[model samples]
Target: MTIAHSLGFPRIGKQRELKKAVEAYWRGKLNQEQLLAEGQKLRQQHWQWQAEAGLDYVPVGDFAWYDQVLNLSCTLGVIPERFLADAKQIPSEVGLELYFKMARGDTNEQGEVAACEMTKWFDTNYHYIVPEFTENQSFAISSSQLLEEIKEAAQQGLKPKPVLLGPLSYLWLGKAKGSDFNKLSLLDELIRVYGELLVKIADLGVEWIQLDEPILTLDLDNEWRQGFETAYNRLQSTPVNILLATYFGALGDNLGTAINLPTEGLHIDLVRAPEQLTSVVDRLPAYKVLSVGVVNGRNVWRTDLQQWLERLQPVKQRIGDRLWVGPSCSLLHSPVDLNQEQQFADDVRQWLAFAVQKNKEIAVLAKALAGDNSTEITAAIEASMAAFKEKNNSGRIHDETIQARVQAIDANMSIRQKPYNQRVVLQRQQLKLPLLPTTTIGSFPQTTAIRAARKAFKAGKLTEAEYRAEMKQQIADAVHRQETLDLDVLVHGEAERNDMVEYFGEQLSGFLFSQHGWVQSYGSRCVKPPIILGDIKREQPMTVEWIRYAQTLTNKPLKGMLTGPVTMLCWSFPREDVSREVSCLQLALALRDEVQDLEKAGIHIIQIDEPAIREGLPLRKAEWQQYLDWAVRCFKIASCGVENTTQIHTHMCYSEFNDIIEAIAALDADVITIETSRSDMELLDAFENFEYPNEIGPGVYDIHSPNIPSQDWIKQLLKKAANKIDLERLWVNPDCGLKTRDWSETEQALANMVAVAKELREEYQAS
Candidate 1:
């Protein structure tokens, strides 16, 4: 019989209980015991759901209080030295505190420590804590969380399969901190820890272990490939049967090395690269189990079960009992449950499936493949087929006017009227500014009163007029604050907007909102993304009124803020029926209309953020240009409609631009601000090497951490940035928006930021 299992499940509860509990713990409302209990409850509930779905084995060790990668870091004793005074001490005593501190920095008698740098997980919106490594890194089995979880699952009478981040991928995902050296050089020591970890899981009576190595989808050199072989060969000696899992994209060249690894099974993602199925089966050993992921894991779209069964039939025939079925990747990228969305249209809701539904789909696929022709199984297959067909042909999803507008897009629409050199001159003449001009990334802190008023307004406790007054008051306060700081530029503070993307989606047509569809973007930070069900088009100006009001309040140039087309698409659950290029172009045209309106509204500066553009790059190097070409075109379409006097700015956070510096330059915004404080100004080397023509704001403060950077510290960072790029074209800003920060931290940080700019300006003039 074919096995049915999952790579992982969404740990955030259906109503986001984990988010609430974690936040409560951080705020001192909940104690450590209560937090651990809450975590256990969530883990048990998720495991029960998987068991109920008829999974052959319930996956343990997938649950985390913050992130799975950070959990693994603690499990393998990879805590950074800053968090621990003594390197020899065991971390488990202060495990939870150490973990939270590593994720969100801490300030104590030991002064302040910055958190470990974070970045996107592959092509997904999920953020993982990037592991920190040094040349002399050592590993040991520290945290007993995974071993304890396996026992808990076994006690529940469910067959448990422990999941772990593969050793090779863990090293590959990390950075070399203090001294530069090959991370792979430390793999022998890392595998020794993994060998011990596997033995512990085996002693817990676990029969199978799923080790995820998603980096196989990326281009790798011979040494990294050889490291995988050596690591797994050492790990294969453990009693537990190993299932090597790869997802996000096709294995391609790595397929040979992956299959040849001394493991009992291999999992391939057929939803992304189904063509690899035949090739994988042809070369696989007959004794090894081949788990084929047929259901979509990264998306909410329902799988066409009938079609998938047809595709899997021949593969099953070749592999017979060795064939297994699951999702394309971990369902951590998906929302918890589709059943919680009570507000969605019936037709639209039918076309969707969350993590819970996806697991049931996996079970149904496995049963059908095993020739279980029961009435219930047949009905599920039929329902899935019907949903897929209706979604494709639904008149609600297609709009002729929007389609025509997208089709009418021309190359001229994607080019600016003037290049950066000419445009900067016009912008400077139009709005005179000083060297190292200080600005923000277009949002002030969203405070408790602000959140309360918005909640009250949404709940109908306040009228539209009353709500507008409250938001206007907040915006005026923000303007006064910026004027007080003596910053060069100002922003409307985005007091009226709930989220950068969701705010725009609410005004646009052809999108669906969810009441309880939240996914974790990073630790304790959950985002409820809008569902893109149909063609996208803007009916009216989204940010004009708020921006115009703020501009009137301040003598300084206030930026008109808008989320870019690529970010709006990549961050949301985009339409599967249309090509991304078509959907993105449609969004670009809509945003283009808004950009022109902002120009007309007397706004001199506009910032359209494309943070997800780098996140949207294809995993395979050979396929990157096709994605970059369309992504750049869409951004240009949104931004290129403005005049040279109207300075266009863009912001990106927590993304590595070294490989895509040319594409970043091609966006052609007059100024670009990025998150560089966490990486300690390392990202500036890319812009400096490329001799990027436009102005830039290499962020001087890390807003994600609550630690207020001192004035001298900000000045030193500015000095580092000045050495790399010309100070003439440099701007000063924070790493990202201050939406998640409190007002006190925001005020102190901006005060220091403005001080750094002023001091730098006077010093440069004197020199």
Candidate 2:
């Protein structure tokens, strides 16, 4: 029998109930019991949904309060010593405080302790806690979260395949802090703990366990590959079968290393590397089951049912009962369901699928292979095939005139006439700025009042005139507050905008939005990325009025905030048939028109944010150049038309810039600000070592959390940043935007930020 399996499901509830509950806990409105209960409720709802959807293999232990990696950190005793009661404690009363501390970091009412470092999770928008290890690291199965979740699934009458990050990948993903050796040196200890956990699951009569080793997709050294051999050798003694799962990209040479492993089953992502399947089928051991990841997991386009059946039929015939159909990776990357997006046109909506819909795709394919040839199912399949055909060659998706314009793009269109040295002189003269000028990233807090007014306007309770008046007031207040805080550049606080990217999408042609099509960016943060339905163009100037209004209130340079082209593509659900590079070029042209409008409207300083740029990097090292080449090209198309004095500023969140510092320098912005507070200037080493040429604003304080940084602390961080780059090249700001934070923290953090800049200037002058 063909079994339909899901890698994982969305943790945030249908209405984002989890986000509300988590935020309430952070604000002291909910206790630990209430929060835990909410988490349990969400887990049950997700499991029941999968089971009812007729999925044969439902996943357990994939649900997390924060992140799956952190959950794994808790299950195994991979915790740093400070987070636990005792250094040698096996399990000393694990509570909510201990778990939350490791994620957001602990700070007293007076605010002191710093957050642990966090970075991008393998180029995704999601952020994961960096596992801090030391020489005295000890391993034990400290917690029962995974075991208990497995038991919970059994009680719910579902066949649970417990998913775990493989020991090799876990050790490989973590950082070795204050240690002189490789973190993989402790791989044996970690594997021992995993083996013990696996034995306990087998004791519960669980037949299969999924060990995800996504690190196989990355470029690995021989030692790392050998470490995999050493690690799985220990796991061979476990009673339960190990299903080694790998995704994100092609295995290439890693295919040989993976198939040769001593595991009962192997799962490879065919949606990304469909070419690998033929090679695997030819060389497979007859006894081992092969799980084929045929359905797309990371995108939104509807799978062509006919094509999927054709792709899977041959594999099912070769493997027979050993074949399992599944998504290419976890559905955690996809939205929950397309059914909730009722606001979209039927034409566009029919051509899409979310996580739940993806599971249905798996089920339909599995049943088709099982000889269930009912008319209803056959008609459904035919409809999906038709939708794919319509979407692929739809006139809405492409315009030949736009394609011609894109093809005609020249070298001169994507570059500034003056170099950074020359541009800076003109900018300094025009702006008359001080050393280490301070600015906010783009937005201020979009408080409850702002949301309420916008909601009222949308629902027709308030008139458009009234809403505009309220927004203008908010903008004036934002300008007044920045002046009182004594900052350099100013922002409009984005009072009229809902999101940085979504605001632009709403004004541009060829896009559709959803009423409830939200996907999780990270913990408790859900973003509804607009669906690109056709070729996009700016109908009119998107932000000129807001920028012009904000500038009229300030003598200081008010930045015209815009979301860059690559970010627009990376953050949104782009059209599937169109190549990503082509879609990005179209967006670049739209934003190019907007940029020129802003410059013409007397808004001299423009900050086009590409925070999603690094998150869009392909997982494999061999593939980075191709992505960066087009990504850089699109950004230049959006930015380069302006004069030198009209400074271009860009912002990136907490990501590993060290690997792509040259690409960052190539953007050639007048200034760049990045998140460095939690990483504690570790991110600045990339800048210092690269000798980054453009002006930099390495953030002085972390803004994601509510923790307010002290001016003294900010000064010390600036001094640390000065170590890597010349002081003249530095700017002062918070890590990211202040949108998630409240007014109190935003005000306090920015005040300290400006004061730090003043102190640094005085110190530099005196010296």
Candidate 3:
């Protein structure tokens, strides 16, 4: 019989119980024992749910207090030298405290320490802690977290298949610290530790281990490809079966290497690249199990069971009992439960599936493939077919007017009226900004009082007028703080907005909101993304009133903040019925209207953030141009409809822009700000190498960490940035928004930032 299983499940509970519990521990509201209890409860509940959904094996070692990648780092004893002291004390004293320190940084007697750098996980919005490496990196089985979790799962009378991040992929996901060296050189040592780990896991009576190596989807050199063969060959001696899993994209050229590996089984994602099914089935060994991921894991849309059955039946016929069925990737990218969304329209609700629903979809497929076509299984297939049919043919999804507007877009709509050099001169003459102008990336800290007001307003406990007054007061305070610091550019603080994307989606047509749809972005940070159901259109100006009100409170040039078209689309659960280019264009047109309105409202500087643009790039380099072409065009369409005197700015955070520097320049914004402090000004190398035109703000402060930077520290970073880019074109700002930070740290950090700008300005004049 075919096996049914999952790559992973959402660690955040249905109502975000993990987030609350973890945050409470951070704030000293809960002790270590209490926090451990909460994590244990969430794990048991998730395992039980998967078992009830008819999974053949429950996934252990997939649960993490923070992130799975970070957990693996701990297990491998890959702690950076900065956190070595904390690690030494972990065996006897510290428990998961050292783990949280590696993730969130710490301020103690050892002085302030920055956390390991983080970046996007593949193309999804989920963020993972990037593993740090050194030239002489050593590996040892340091933590027993995975071993403990396996025993815990086995105690519950469920078959636990441990999921481990494959050795090659773990090294590939990491960066070489100190100096440049081939990370693959450490592969031999890494495999030794992995071999030791497999033996211990097998000793626990585990039958199968899911080893994920998603890097097979990427273009690899011969050295990296050979390293995979070498590593797996060494690990094949372990007395356990290894199911090599790859997802997020198709394994194109690496298919030969992957199939030849000495693993007992291989998992392929059929949702993203179903075209590879025939090729894989033809080449796969007869003795090896082929896990077919037929259910979509990265999306919310319900799968069409009839269509998938047609696709999977041919593969099942070829492979017979060796076939397995599951989700395309980890359900960690998806929300917890669809049943929690009680506020959604019935039609809209029927058209969606969260993590729990997707698992059931996997089970139903497994039964159908096994020829168990009971009435219940047949009804599930029928319901899935009906939901998809209704979604495709629904009148509410198609708007003739919006479609016509998207069709009518022309080349002229995407080009600026003048070039950057000419526009910069006009912007400078009008605004009269300083040399090293200091500003924020919009959004002051979202204080508890501010959240309370928004919650009260939503609950109808406070009237709209009362809520507006509360927000206006918060905006006023933000403006006063910036003016006192003598920062050159100002933002409205975004006090009235809940989320950058959700705020706009709430006011737009053809969008659906969820009451409990939340997914983790990083540590303890969760975002409830809006679902784009149909053609997008703006009914009225989204940010004009709040921005205009903010401009009235400050003499400085306040930036009109808007989330860019690509980010708005990428961050949300976009429409699957239409092409992404079409949906992005429709969103661009809607934002185009808002951009013009912000200009009319007398807001001179506008910042449209496209942080997710880099995240949205296709995994395959061959397919990048198609995505970049439309992505850049959509951004231009939204931002180009403005005067030369109106300075347009864009901000990107926690992304590697080296490969896409040309595309970044093509956006043609007057100024661009990016996250740099966490990488210690490493991202600036890309802009310098490309001789990127237009002004820039290389963030001098790492806002993600709680540790505050001294004024001197900020000055040194700015000086380092000056060495790469021209001084006149440089601006000063933080790595990203301060919404997640506390007001106390936000104020002190901005003060230090402004002080650095002043010290640098005087030094440049003296020189």
TM for every model, in the order presented, reads 0.98, 0.97, 0.98
Q: In terms of TM-score, which candidate is stronger, 1 or 2?
A: 1
Residue-wise C-alpha lDDT for candidate 1, range 370-459, written one tens digit per residue: 999999999999988888887777888888999888888889999888888888888899999988899999888899999999999989
Which regions in candidate 3 have their CA more than 4 angstroms from the true location? 86-94
Runs of candidate 2 with Cα error greater than 4 angstroms are 85-90, 109-111
Question: Which is the winner by lDDT between candidate 1 and candidate 3?
Answer: 3
TM-score of 2: 0.97
Q: 1-767, model 3: which lDDT tens digit per residue?
A: 66889999999999899999999998899999999999999999999999999999989988888889999998988888888664443242225888998898887785677888889998989889999998989888888889999999999999999998999999999999999999998999999999999999999999999999999999998999999999999999999999999998899999999999999999999888989999999999979999988788888999888998888888888889899999999999899999988888888888999999999999988989888889999999999888988877789888999989988999999999999989889999999998989999998889999999999999999999999999999999999988998888999899999899999999999898888989999989999998898889999888899889989997889999999999999999987778889999999999999999999999889999999999999899999999999999999999999999999999999998789999999999999999988788999999778889899999888888888988877988899999998999999999899999998999889988888788889989899
Better lDDT candidate (2, 3): 3
Best by lDDT: 3
Off by over 4 Å in 1: 86-94, 108-110
The 10-residue segment with the lowest total lDDT in model 2: 85-94
Question: What is candidate 1's CA lDDT for residue 484?
Answer: 91
| Model 1 vs. true fold: TM | 0.98
Could you tell which candidate, 1 or 2, scores higher by lDDT?
1
